[model samples]
Target: MSLDTTTLLAIVAMALVTYVTRIAGLFVADRLVLTGRAKAAFDAIPPAVLVAVIAPTALTTGWVEAIAAAITAVAAFRLPLLGTVAVGVISVVLLRNVL
Candidate 1:
């Protein structure tokens, strides 16, 4: 698929906005003294962001996607991150086409 000018410009705009906000936040936060609770919350950022990005799409797609996501979640505890993702993607694709 070819990206048109509008799509390219939109992507650039999004990138610029993301960088500006991230940099500004870092600049501001660097000067602050973080407390214990705040530090704990900061440490939770990765998983919280992952869930925020993944949960809605996984839940809304269909039962196949939901089951795949559930399996991925369980697999995540026992398998490597890459393996869990592979299981989820394969299951979702197979289930979607089969049923």
Candidate 2:
């Protein structure tokens, strides 16, 4: 199979842009100090983004996935990150098999 030139160029460009953006973020992050509401907001971002991504898939897929997602959300609050992920995976697998 032959590699297309345009595809290769696009891939290279994307890699370069990602690398530059990460490096820029690192430099900016060194000088950045978040406080009070800003710190709280910043801390919330990861979970918010996680929900934003997973919510659609969980809601759209099926009842079993929806239930599993709900269970996972509850576990997320009670458990640590790894435990939460474990619950999500295990619940989904068990639900898919049982229902």
Candidate 3:
């Protein structure tokens, strides 16, 4: 019914954590050396991270949507970055509205 100090503090702390975590990478990147192996790892990281993140979401939704998203992702992978994003957004919006 009333705003409490503990809840307010917790919310502020969470916001700070989110902001720091997101921006921390920029600071960390400036500090790090991108050597041969590090460069390779960094290059490979995007696809690896994408699969890691997408696989679970796609699988959980169901075979149909999952397969659709995968197909869209693959197609997007081949297209220009903006095109890929457009394809993905269009697919999701159509699916959500139609189904």
Candidate 4:
């Protein structure tokens, strides 16, 4: 099937935007002088991002999710990150079904 001119233009526009965003991210990262606190914060970004994303969802979902999050927080201190996530997910599933 042939794509219309408008569709083709839209696809090209999206491709350019995607490429520009990726290039801009690299350019900005190269310019940043991450030292001291900045370096520490940058290193913490992945976990911080996860908490920022997960916290809101956990809070808004039902009691099961909040309970799972609480349990996960405790497990996180003892387990690895992936282990914490797995425990949290399995707990959620069990809580959802059992409660």
What are the lDDT figures for the candidates, one per model?
Answer: 0.90, 0.95, 0.82, 0.95
Ranking by lDDT: 2, 4, 1, 3
Model 2 agreement with the true structure over 24-44: per-residue lDDT tens digits: 999997888999998899899
Better of 3 and 4 by lDDT: 4
Q: TM-score ranking from best to worst?
A: 2, 4, 1, 3
Writing each residue's lDDT as its tens digit, candidate 1 over 3-94 gives 89999999999999999999999899889888899989988999899989999999998888888889889888899888988988888888
Q: Give all TM-scores, in the order shown.
A: 0.62, 0.78, 0.59, 0.69
lDDT of candidate 3 over 1-99, digit per residue (tens) = 899999999999999999999899889988998989989999999979987998798789876567568768788758987887677777777776677
Model 4 lDDT at residue 69: 96
RMSD of 1: 5.9
How many residue pairs collide in each prediction?
Answer: 0, 0, 0, 0
Model 1, global lDDT: 0.90
lDDT (tens digit, per residue) of candidate 4 on 1-99: 988999999999999999999999999999999899989989999989989999999999889999999999999999998999899999999999999
58: Cα error in model 2, Å: 1.6
Is 1 or 2 the stronger prediction by TM-score?
A: 2
lDDT for position 54 in model 3: 83
